[model samples]
Target: MAETPAADVHPPYLYPDYKSTRLRAPAQPLVRVAPSPLDTAGPTFPKHFVKDSEADLTTWGKSAPLGEKMVLVGRVLDEDGRPVRRSLVEVWQANASGKYPHPVDDHEAPLDPNFLGKGQVLTDDKGRYRIVTVKPGAYPWQNHAFGWRPAHIHFSLFGNAYAQRLITQMFFPGDPLLAIDPIFQSVPEAGRRLLIADLDLEHGVEGVALGYRFDMVLRGPRATPMGV
Candidate 1:
């Protein structure tokens, strides 16, 4: 049995700064359960299930979604520094106006009729994935008086089995709100930097869109912090 690494790169479940965590974090120690054969052997997604076009969120609508268009590209790697090929990567984000299309989002910003704000793609043989999307906008939240969330994109990744799922968020470079946002502050200072993507001019399509790179390490001392 391999020992689980210390969750030094992950955020605490009960980070007081993130007020909601206080109400939901387990008060008791988590119980451990051995995985059954079923838990470790299934839940695979077929490549055809996710069409290549599904990876581009900006093209889904009848017309271009309004916002700064950008491309996000990166690789998914395991703790051993090897690619986790063909993994499923899903992303969701608020529209350019900082409003989600869901009914629960009461933010006054107008939703983009051309942008559903969600997309998914399977990593290639080298664990590389790409997404074309508009840069999300900052939105007001009730976490604190005059609170607002920084622009960010939510990411969900799944390994060969359901047990290998991980969820996190990606932010852009030099976002001012990041310093004051409680959710972003929950992670340790060292791990916090991993959540921010880097601007990569080489990946940018000339005059088409800017490019950002955000790689995710599944686990290890250098693992990217899990948002949840």
Candidate 2:
């Protein structure tokens, strides 16, 4: 994991405390990602990056206080390697405590009335999407006291034409929880590697400009499977 400077304890935007362990950055370059292997068709992904990217509801942020600036950037594609134009990508994170910003969360974390902990964006023809949101903090659960969630962002994406939606979470390179989190450990080791994202140390994104590439392939109809 690359080393990231410590962000102040922002009330609404909670980030986990990194113990400063050196983790190696991902080996693959920040290139577009491939679609889920389940999509045997190997068709081109849609291309509508930024074409229809917008928040269906700004209230998702809930007017919680904001830092000087914040944004999340990533790409989405399909089985055929085409961009899923205007595909809606929804995300929700805890209010700094790994607890959701919703009032129903029994956890005692403070909720940023304006920070709804949710946001949306659309993928471009290039199969990419970007969102401006505060960094989420890691919080504890009955699972573990030091059980902080690896600093991460949740991503929910709708595949072509709203047929089916894929929901997954993106984790920072070195939050220290990926090794112990049961949820993170659930996926097969081969697929588990997909969720790990690369840090944008050079893109010069204003705040935490994290980069991720997730291409969804909703297995549909009989299709020839690719021989791996």
Candidate 3:
């Protein structure tokens, strides 16, 4: 009989901690539960929903979501540099007003009745996906005396299986708040560049929406530093 090998752990410096010196890192589950029959033989990769691959944050209701219209596009690739096709990608972000459409958000900004601030899309055969949304505004936080979070969008990706899922936040390239935001600083400086989306007019529609390209590499030497 052969023994099992140890798992590869993520780099610690990349993840943020409220009190890293005192608090211990997350512990891996004791048992590796095998996928159940339902999970192993699920319907399709992603079950069809009312809006499975709709990435436009605007146009949910009678009017479009407010703010600067921009296009977000990216490719999903595995550690081996192979594309992960048909992966489900989901994104949630604050409106241009820097407020979410949730009760927990106490920001003074007014919410757009038409903007739900959530969307989902699937990667195509080339491992590419795109979404159209407004640039989220920076919001104040209570972390410090005058804490504020940089404009960012939360992203979730699911590969062929749930175990291959990945989650991260995408930031704009020139956000001034990046220097002061502790959450953005959590990632090691070397890996921080991977989180910022770049401006790419090539991917944008002519005079329609500005384009930002954010590629994600799941695991390995080029893995995007995931938030703790």
Best by lDDT: 1
- The CA lDDT of each predicted structure is 0.84, 0.53, 0.75
* Most accurate candidate by TM-score: 1
Best-to-worst order by lDDT is 1, 3, 2
TM-score between model 3 and native: 0.79
lDDT of 3 by residue, 1-228 (tens): 111122232234224333352245544434544555433322245446526437777778688777888999999987677787777888999999999989899999989888888999878888898898889999998767688899999998876544456788999998999998877776667778889999998888787788899999765212332221
RMSD of 3: 6.3
Model 1 residue 8 distance off true place after TM-score fit, in angstroms: 0.9
Q: What is the lDDT of candidate 2?
A: 0.53
Ten residues in sequence with the least summed lDDT for candidate 2? 6-15
TM-score of each: 0.90, 0.61, 0.79
Where does the lowest 10-residue lDDT sum fall in candidate 3? 1-10
lDDT of 1 by residue, 18-108 (tens): 8898788877665556655554544678879899998899998899999999999999987777787888999999999999999889899
Q: Which residue window of length 10 is worst by lDDT in model 1?
A: 219-228
Q: Which stretches of candidate 2 lie over 4 Å from their true place?
A: 1-70, 143-146, 161-164, 204-228
Clashes of 2: 29
